[model samples]
Target chain A: MQFWIVQSLNSLALGGLLFLLATGFSLIFGLMRIANLTHGALFMLGAYVGVTTLKFVPNLWLAALIAGLLVALFGGLLERSILRRLAGNALGQVLVTLGVSFIVADFCLIVWGGDPIPIAAPTSLQRPIVVGNIAFPAYRLVVLGIAIITAIALHLLMERTRLGAMIRAGVDDMQMARAVGVPVSRLFTTVFCLGAALAGAGGVIAGPIMSAYPGLDADMLPLALIVVILGGVGSLLGAFVGSFVIAIIYTFGSALLPDLAYVILFLPMIVVIAFRPRGLFGRRST
Target chain B: MSAAARIVLVLVLVAFPLIGGDFYINLASQIFIAALFATSLNLLVGYGGLVSLGHAAWIGLAAYTSAWLYLHLGLRHWITAPLALVNTTLIAGLFGWIALRATGLGFLMITLALSQVLWGTAYRWAAVTNGDNGLSGLTRPAPFGISLDGPAAFYYFSLTVTIVAVWMMARLVNSPFGAALRGSRDESRRMSALGHNVWLVRWLTFVYSGFWGAVAGLLFVYYHKYIHPTALSLTSSAEVLLGVIAGGAGTIAGPIVGAAIVLILKNYVSAYLDRWNMLLGAVFVVIVIFMPDGIVPGIRRWSARLRKT
Candidate 1:
């Protein structure tokens, strides 16, 4: 029972981080219909920046905010200078984004020297929280809390706000939205930046646990892709659910069948694809 | 170019290995193998309208199968090669049966998921795949009477296979089945409404793609004398996609041209600059911005405009 509880908590922590990374990817895909492969690279940049900023700011929250904003700006620049040029061409977009990912990964390697950079947990959240005989990392619980808040905040924004409405409208029908003066192009850029910011935020929160490293992007990106697919493309709620499920599979599967953990991580996805190709919450095309 | 011109071009390509230096010969061979891989990708993306981000799984599967057969079963080259191709086709057919049910972005994601599954399997199945250590020490042997140990001999063997494969693809693409696949690509619902099974066509095309990928894998295993999990990774898939896009999807010869450019650039740029990735990124950005229709299409458009003048 104690082992199960710990595993469950670990899954929540992993799921929270995955949700953060995948939220941005889902947003970009929903709005632009373009697979921003460099989204992973942006997440890496966020972790690095958050760690670097913490050295000066001395406040974890402030560092995360600054990192998120900076990553958002970088995303905006990428949209304006590169992605804008490859609009409507999926293959071109994939190639360009992949190229961008390679550049970011290699640049990180050069700057960080292939070593994992340790990030200190916030002083206030460093202790372990006791729940009966089982103790869970306080920082991980904080991460879970933050993730829940973020999801709720995003849901409210998407469902209630005017900007969110415009974004949704654009996602549904770009041509119709453009005809009604929705500024589809500008909206795409904004959404891309917003998604990047979320990824950055996730990276910042996950930094202490995972550590910022050169090859971390490769691992995170695939996990994010899996989460996005399992959750369904364009569904934020789906991302959250998918993340938890995948995390749970990872934690328990590894424990139960160590040799088959990797295959087990993919089994749920395969089953999901087999049964629900659009994902758990994907909107059906009429 | 006329038919005669094309034949002459092919002849020149074949003889260039003899005249060129060792480095150039090796480079050409690498390009040919890559071209074969890209061409296989082209069958799905260009003709079937299926953008598979995980097509590298086929190549990786073929490599591992061939290597395993050589190691455990002590299979001859001729036997193993055919077995590899057949195995790849069967696996691809199974995967495609599930994947072809989805369309557009959904299909792409499914393929990516499937590729990851294969990569994970390769990593964890240590006893069979040797985990990250990879399968090594498989050498090119005298297959049925021909010595393939020398680079020159191997290059000719690869070239012959590539030519035959390309020719087969050309014939396949012009056949009635190919026409039906293209029709489905243009409008799957309409084809299905007309009583044709779009799913079957897509699955068959996917199988063909896998067959070609397996052929490329055979050449790769022979050339490198090793196989690893990286062969099935997302990176390899992405590289093949890059080659397909850079050349021009839908064009018969686009992948070959694209493969040459990509491999040559990587070789030359990496030799001089440590930040070759930045250069590669810049190149991709420029290509997408200026040549959205790809190099072949751009060239065709320019030549057409000149002819009009």
Candidate 2:
């Protein structure tokens, strides 16, 4: 029972970080119909920037915020310069982003020199929180709390705000949304930046636990994509549910079926995909 | 464009091995193998309208199968090659059935996921695969009593197989079945209305392409005398896709040309440049942005315009 609880909590931490990464990816994919492969590169950038910022800022939260904002700014520039030109061309979108990612990954390697480094956890959150005979890393609890808050905030933003309505309208029909005077292009840039920022935040939070590395982009991109696809391509709720399921599968699958863990990890996705082609919460049309 | 021109091109490639000595012969062999891989990928992307991002899985699968069979079962390359091709086709058929149940992005994602599963197995299954250390020091098989040990001999063997494969693909794309696949790609509902089995067409295409991709892997193992998990990577898949796009999809000669360009850049240009990836990325970006139709079609259009002028 104790082992199960601890594993479950660990899953929660992993799931939380995944949620941030997948939601942004899901949103951009949903609205833009672009795979945004560079989002993973942005996540790596966030982690690296966070690590760099830690040397100067001395506050983990502030450094993370700065890092995420910088990544978001870069995402906006990417949208303005490259993605804007390739509208409605799916293959072009995929290829261009892939190229950009390659360039960014190489650039990261040049700058960071291919070493795995971790951002230090906040001093306050460094201690372990105990319950009866069980003890958990306090930083993990912070991650869980941050994730929940971020999810709720995103939910409210999408569900309640005017911009959310415009985004939803655009997602449904870009032509109709444009006819109604919604600034679709600017909105796309904004949504893309928000998505990048969220991905960066995921990296920052996951940095202490997973470490910042050159290959993190490649490793996390697939995981985030799995989360997005499993959750349902454009559905926030689907992303949340998918993240938890995947994180649990990854954690417990490793624990239980050490040898065939990857097979076990992909099993749920295969089963889920077999039944729900559009994903758990994805619309049929999309 | 003319039959005479095509014949001349083929003659040049064929005769080059005889005259170009060792380094060029080896390089030409690599290009032919890569061309074969790209051509197979183009069959799906160009004719079938299925842009698979995990096409390297097929190549990786066959490479591993050939290597394993040779190492463990003491099988000849002649036997192992056919087995590898058949094995790849079987796996492709299975995965294609599942992937084709969904359309567009779902299809791409499913293929990517399936390939990742294979890569994971290759990375983690250490006892059989040797994990990251990779399998090396393989010898070329003397299939059909042909000597494929030397660079010259191997080049001719690879060239012969590639020519036959390319010819087969050329014939296939011009066939009634190829017409149907193209029809399904452009007008799926119409093709279905006309009583064509659209899903079946795609599934068959996937399996067929897998056969060719596996053949590339077989050749790669024999040529390099080694195999690694990197063969199964997303980068390998991307490189093939880049070749397909650069040469121009939906054409026989385009992917071959693209493969030649890519391999030449990798082998020759990278020798001088430390930042080869950045250069490659810049080139790809330029190609996508400017020559979106690809080099072949782009040149054709320019020539047509020039003729008119």
Residue A88 CA error for candidate 2 (Å)? 1.7
DockQ for candidate 2: 0.51
For candidate 2 chain B, the 10 contiguous residues with the lowest summed lDDT are B273-282
**Cα-based TM-score, every candidate:** 0.94, 0.96
DockQ, structure candidate 1? 0.47
Minimal lDDT window, size 10, model 2 chain A: A257-266
Give the CAPRI class of candidate 2.
medium
lDDT of 2 by residue, A75-135 (tens): 9998889878888887788778888888888898889888898788889989899999999
Chain A TM-score, prediction 1: 0.96
Q: What is the lDDT of candidate 1?
A: 0.84
Classified by CAPRI criteria, candidate 1 counts as: acceptable
> Whose DockQ is greatest here?
2
